[model samples]
Target: MYYPTIRGCIQALKNLEIWLDKAEQHAAAKGFDVGVLLTSRLAPEPSSIS
Candidate 1:
């Protein structure tokens, strides 16, 4: 059980790296700052969560 969980976590980290690389490339191609994309949130603001 622990082995599978650890493996999944490793895979997730790998996937995140790949995603960040793609996002960086995309932002560069569109003439935007990579930092803007990196700092973006997928969910609504904290005040709206309530």
Candidate 2:
């Protein structure tokens, strides 16, 4: 199986961060903890190629 390159992984993480930031802001306005609902990949996980 072909895995994502470092650049691709970086891009995916960046996009995830943006979405997570938005969700966090929304949750904060409602008095909720974002961390409880979100998890960040400090390192990438294995992905199966289809």
Candidate 3:
């Protein structure tokens, strides 16, 4: 059970990195600053879980 949980966590992190890289590329292709994209968030407020 713990092994599957750990694997899932690792996979989630890898997926996040992949998404960030894609965002960076998309920003560059659109002639926008990657920093702007990086700083922008989908959430208007901070999460309690973090």
**Best candidate (score: lDDT):** 1
Better candidate number, 2 or 3, judged by lDDT: 3
- TM-score order of candidates, top first: 1, 3, 2
Off by over 4 Å in 3: 42-50
Q: TM-scores, in order shown?
A: 0.75, 0.53, 0.72
The better candidate by TM-score, 1 or 2, is 1
Clash number for each model: 0, 0, 0
* Local distance difference test values of all predictions, in order: 0.96, 0.78, 0.92
> TM-score for model 1?
0.75
Rate residue 22 of model 1 by lDDT.
98
lDDT tens digits by residue: candidate 3, 7-32? 99999999999999999999989999
Report the C-alpha lDDT of model 1 over 1-50, residue by residue, as the tens digit: 99999999999999999999999999999999999997889998999999
How well is each residue in 1-50 modelled by candidate 2, as lDDT tens digits? 23558778889999999998899898899897887566655546656332
Winner of 1 and 2 under lDDT = 1
Q: What is model 3's C-alpha RMSD? A: 5.4
Residue 50 local lDDT, model 2: 29
Q: Over all chains combined, what TM-score does candidate 3 have?
A: 0.72
